[model samples]
Target: MASTTIQRSAARTEVEGAARTERPRGAIAFGLTRIAIGWLFLWAFLDKAFALGFATGRAEDGSIDFFAKGQAWLNGGSPTEGVLRYATKGPLAGFFQSLAGAAWVDWVYMLSMLLIGGALVLGVATRLAAVGGAIWMALFYLATSIWPEYNPVVDEHIVYILVLVGLAQIGAGRYLGLQERWERSALVRRFPVLR
Candidate 1:
């Protein structure tokens, strides 16, 4: 009877240990998704910062440089102009349009993009980044709300906002990011909001 009890206790401990270490289903997929979205933000930052011409460059050959000579933000190019001019269509269209080419607006937009992208890519301060990204996406969605041709009231912005929120709720950074170290840091402990 003593031997049986010991065996049962040991078996239960082993099972519990395994359960504690076991990853949730689809963890890898979720991590990959987070990385992919992070890359999207990072790529946008790179494209705009360097004007590597994905969509903002002009070639000396008098043709649009789809791959080079773009109007880089550092080179005094306004990233908000094109989108604000063409994509804006809601009741606040004029408001956003007026912000185009404004120096302060340009600086804020560029800085926000860089910070958000960097945080997401590095998996540092991801919850904060997600909140900022969601707010940014919400603004874009509101500015471009005229969209029956695309979908019935849902758009890329809304999808991105939802994804950001989901990532935050799931503590996605903890899975494969620097979140473990971040969470253990004194700053995080001192300011729990950073976690």
Candidate 2:
């Protein structure tokens, strides 16, 4: 009877441990940072996609309109056309410009923003999101200013990359996000990177 009791206790303990995710004291900080970075991507996507006019979809009079049909992606405005064609200044200008206004490229960029932002914000698939977001930011850095005025080898993109790596390394998503439950999912078990 004692042996059976011990076995039951052990099993119960194991299940409890598995069900309870531990959050470090610093979890809040990392989770907040993740949300902030995610918002950068998400906000950009919203502004561009809907032309909210903080940066895009401005009228000829420089007035702002919510969901204005003039320059929104929905209205056929190209999210990247102005930047790639007119604002690209680095040695890769031609390359960047070549991708300007292409419907397919716009779709890809928009989708990247939505997916990466959503993943990071929701605290699921953060590793994959970090990888994809880092690549996207790096490309943006390369296109706009290969030789940044203030620094030769560092910029916001690089900082973001470092933070992303740190987040992945520490499992930032597990702290306050849905990461623990997400990892227990069978699909994530099969693909650890999705964690």
Candidate 3:
């Protein structure tokens, strides 16, 4: 009887080993996708930081005012005629518009871009970055949504946000990011669902 039990266990192990040997389904593809997504955020941050000149359109200022750019677009050659004015025209618009040309605006925009883009590329606080990225993309979508032909209905930025959200939901960082360390920490382990 003991011999028979041992034989059965060995058979089970063999079967499991065989299953493990089977080709994995799209693992490489998924990893590549994640890396590509990270690259996107990295590129965006770099592009805006060095070349695009943030929201202020003041590359000389060396700061990024993300919202300021939108404002400029709206007041200037923006396709979204009243959208920016309508949303920002209230007391809030007046307040931010005041800061539009200010140096502080550049600092804020640069910092925000760095934080959001850095965290996303590194996969640290992935869920947080994902949510933030989504909001950012949504705003862009709003700006572009006003014009169908020039801006179009579909944008890659939106897709990247969605992918970020999905990866965060699955804790994709565990496989290849700081999220693995994050997840194992007391903060995450205690909650077990924080991420």
Candidate 4:
């Protein structure tokens, strides 16, 4: 009887260990997704800040420089102007356009891009980043009007918002991000919402 009890206890322990070690389906996929999205935001920040020529640079050869000659933000390139003047369309078009190139707008846009990208990439403060990203995407969605021409009534911005929300809900950062350590920090312990 004693041996049977010990064997049963050992078996249970093994089962629990296996369960603990088993990762959920798609955990890796979700982690990759998080990384990809994080890069998306980060890349935008890099491109806009340096005018790396993907969207905001000029080349001496009069060709679109995919790698050089950007109108750096520090050197006085208005990232908001192009979006406001060309991409914006809808009820807020005029309002957004008017605010384009404004000092406050530039600061807010640059800051949000950096913060959101950093948070997502590091897997820290992801919930806050998701919220901010969703808000930013929502504004873009509304500005673009979700038109069929641009998108079939659903676009990249909307997809990004959903993905950001999912990343926050699943704590994707915990799988491969700094979320595990972040959650253990005193600040997170006191304010669970940070998780």
**Each model's total of backbone clashes:** 1, 0, 3, 1
Write one digit per residue (lDDT tens) for candidate 3, span 135-189: 7666555443423344455666567667767766655554445666776778877
Name the TM-score of candidate 3. 0.53
Q: How far out, in Å, is residue 167 in model 3? A: 1.7
TM-score of each: 0.81, 0.83, 0.53, 0.80
How many backbone collisions does model 3 have? 3
Summed over model 1, clashes come to 1
Q: How accurate is candidate 2 locally (lDDT)?
A: 0.85
Quote the lDDT for 20 in model 3: 54
Candidate 2, residues 15-115, lDDT tens digits: the string is 88866556556779999998898888888899998999888867779888767765688877888888889878778999999998898999999999999
Minimum summed lDDT over a 10-residue window in model 3 is located at 73-82
Instruction: Write down the worst ten-residue block by lDDT for model 4.
Output: 63-72
Candidate 1 stretches greater than 4 Å from native: 1-22, 58-70
Ranking by TM-score: 2, 1, 4, 3
Model 3 residue pairs with clashes: 55-65, 55-69, 64-109
Q: Please, what is the whole-model Cα lDDT of each candidate in the order they appear?
A: 0.78, 0.85, 0.55, 0.79
Ranking by lDDT: 2, 4, 1, 3
> Looking at candidate 2, what is the lDDT of residue 69?
69
- Please report how far candidate 4 places residue 177 from its true position, in Å: 1.0
lDDT of 4 by residue, 8-125 (tens): 9999999988776555678888778877888777877888888777766767676665434326676677767778778888777888788777878877888888888887889888
